[model samples]
Every structure is written in C-alpha cells, then in structure tokens.
Target: MSDIIAHTGSAFRLTLRRAGRSLLARIGCDCPLCGARVAGARLCAGCESDIAGSMADPAVPRCPRCALRLRHGHCAACLAGAPPFSRCVAAFDYEPPADILVHMLKSGLRLSMAPVLAGMMARACARQGLVLPAGAVLVPVPAGRASLRRRGMNPAAEIARALAGELDIPLARAVLARRRETPRQATLDRRARRRAAQGLYVCREPLAGRHAVLVDDVMTTGSTVRAAAQALIAGGAQDVTVLVAA
Candidate 1:
C-alpha cells in the first residue's frame, strides 16, 4: 500500500509541474528589443510601433526598383541598368532598433523573431501597395553550407517559412541553392561584391510560367538577390520580386 501511494504522489507531482510550465508559457516573457514584459508576443506594442514608423519613410525619396534611399532621383545603379528582380520590398531601413532585431535573429540565434519579422514584412508589402501575382511562390535565398553548419539553421529559410504562413503563399524551400561557398559579402567592396555574387546561385527546379518572391533577411549592395533572381529567371521563372526583412 505504501509503494502504491508513493507512485501516485510522484505522478501527481509530475502533472503539477507540467501544468505550471504551461501556465508560465501562457503568461509571457520579456520583449527581445526593449526587455519589456510581453504577453504571447515577441515584441512589446511600443517597440513594434516604433519599428514600423522607421520603415521606408514616405517623405524620403527612394528608388522604386531597389528601395535605396535617394537624395534627388533614382539611384545610379538602378538607373544604369535594370536589375533581375522587378522590385524590392523592405520591411524597414537597416538602421538602429530594426537592425538590432535582425542581428538578434541572424547572429544571436533568436529564432522566435522570425514570425514577428514576417508579420512586419507582410505589413510593409501592404503599405507599399504591393501585390503578389497569382501562383507566386516564396523562395528563400539559400545560405552557404558553412553558414548552415555554424548556425545550425538558415535565418532566411525561417523567415520565409513564417512569411509563407502569413501570406498564404507556397514555399519552395529547395528551389534555389548556392553554387559554392564564397567570402561573406559584408567584407567585400561594391564592385567586388557584385563580381563575386555573379552566378553564385542556381535553381534546382524548373519554374516555368511562375512568379517567384525571393525572401531574405537583409539587402546591402543587392548583389546577392540579383544573382539569385538571375538564376530563377534562367530556370524559367516569369518574374522575380525581392522581399527582405531589413
């Protein structure tokens, strides 16, 4: 009788612990950006609003094709020649608190930020009056094998997964792949980056007659996406659109 009672007590304690954990999870945690308490969300309301406000300001002139901030007219690069992608949509400028969130996800490995960032990207697209063509698919830029090995996951793929859920678009996770591991673009100059990124990506599957929305975490010189878009076009994608969280 004592043994049976002991076993019952252990089972009861285990159930209580699980219930406690579930309750804590529901109660919420601190926001990643401001450290404020948030309920069932990654960021607090104030932080989200501030980040949204910092997104592509209407007053500032920006390139329609690449979203680069401009002083008077379109950027020289966009004007010089047409890029492979039709247009680029960015959730926010790569600065300050927005950049902090991106670094947290990309380098700090805070994977929970993926869905939050995706939600923002969706909102940005709406604000820009952007529309995905019928039958458009979301394709994440493939990370190099070295990056994958170091991070144990691809940040772009995570964002794409969440964005796919938010936009109700099909995700073609494996449709694009890197041709080889190259030096990080952040270390290269503009000309070097462009040259290095050329032919860096290859499409693994045919995308005939389909529009592709290429997703990534950030866009600096735009070389990476340009290369990926070229590969998609070569693989028969009718049109390519670039979407980035930064």
Candidate 2:
C-alpha cells in the first residue's frame, strides 16, 4: 500500500513538473542549456553553435556502413565485411555536450528535448547526403517490457516519433519487439555482446518490402542495430538504415 502510494505521488509530481514546463514553453522560456531566454528556441545561439561544432567533421571521411569516422577511404572493419544495415548516420560524436544531453533524456526522462535533438539529427543527415528513401518508415528500436516498466517510456521511441515528423516519414512503433529479457550489453565485451544480442529481437509486423530506418539514441559497437536490422529483414523489410543522435 505504501509503495503504491509512493509511486502515485511520484507520478503526480512528475506530471505537475511537466505541466509547468509546458506552460513556460508556451509563453517564454530560457534555453535548455545556458538558461538564457531564447523565446521560441530550445537552445541559445551560442549553445547551438557549440553543438554544431561538436559534429563538424567534414574532412575526415566516415564509414558508409556504421558512420564511424574513418582515416582512409573506408574503415578497415567495414572493408572486411559490412553489417546487415545498408547505411548509418550519426548527428554528433558521443562526447561532452552530446553525452550530457543524451543522459538527460535517457536517465532523467527529459522528453522535451527529443524534438530538438531529432531535428538536429535530421539536418545533419541531410548535410551529409543521407536521405531516406521514399516510403521509408521510422522504426524505433524497441525497449523490453522490463525496461519500459522501469523508465515509463522508451527514449528511442520518443526520438523516433519526433524524427518521423521532421523527416515527413511514418512512425511504426509496433513493428518490432524484444522476444525475451536479455542481459545488459554494457555488462559484456564485443564478441560476447554480439552473441548476447543475437536473436533477441522479433518482428511483430509484416514489413513486406518497406524501407526501415532504425532509430536509437546512441550507436556504440553497432551490435544492437545490426541485430535489429536482421529481424527487420526477416520480417520482409527491403533494407534498414541506421539513424542515431550520438
């Protein structure tokens, strides 16, 4: 009884806070980063410039497969063999301000930032010529039921929802799902991670030759995205494109 009451109280407080923030957003608001009044913008000019600078790597080529910054034309690993995905794009490097912002969304449940970040990512993809194919759908990598129960929402789904709007694509939330609980990827090494992620995802709907853009907050080893692409392909998706904010 006490636990239930505490949960309800916490939820109420979160709701109240979100409502207050929404009200401020409607009238006027400070930038999410520096607290300077930006009126209609999510970020102040200076912060926006900083965020752009963090991802400004044009001279260095990136791997077409995983979007990793490359030295020679193609990354050695990619040259050896490509993953299941056709292409990948990342908006920012997993560093400093980007890291902080992702942490805020994933851990703190600051969903208000999703649209801003997704817009930036979509713009970045355009600048790099990573356009989505016509009729492609934005499919967020699904979170397990256990994870959803704990976080109350899926950060990847939130980002994908916003990104679909920005890209003018349809969002497919129930196309894929986790088949069963799996160990955390962070608790494993590269080889172990790949093995652990294998066959973890199941396609819940028939894609039937539809193009899929897998959305996630971050792409580290690319293992998660690869597994997801496999599931999508098995479900009759024509191909998978990887999209991530960091």
TM-score for candidate 2: 0.81
lDDT of each: 0.86, 0.81
Best by TM-score: 1
lDDT (Cα, tens digit) per residue for candidate 2, span 66-102 = 8887867767656766888888888877887657778
* Total clashes in model 1, counting residue pairs 3 or more apart in sequence or in different chains: 0
Per-residue C-alpha lDDT of model 1 across residues 10-81, encoded as one tens digit per residue? 789767865754564467778878899887435687887787775556777888888877866769878777
Model 1: per-residue Cα lDDT at residue 215? 98
Could you list the CA RMSD of all candidates, in the order they appear? Answer: 9.8, 9.3
Off by over 4 Å in 2: 1-27, 39-41, 71-77
TM-score, per-candidate, Cα-based: 0.84, 0.81
User: How far in Å is the alpha carbon of 24 misplaced in model 2?
Assistant: 12
Q: Give the least accurate 10-residue stretch of model 1, judged by summed lDDT.
A: 17-26
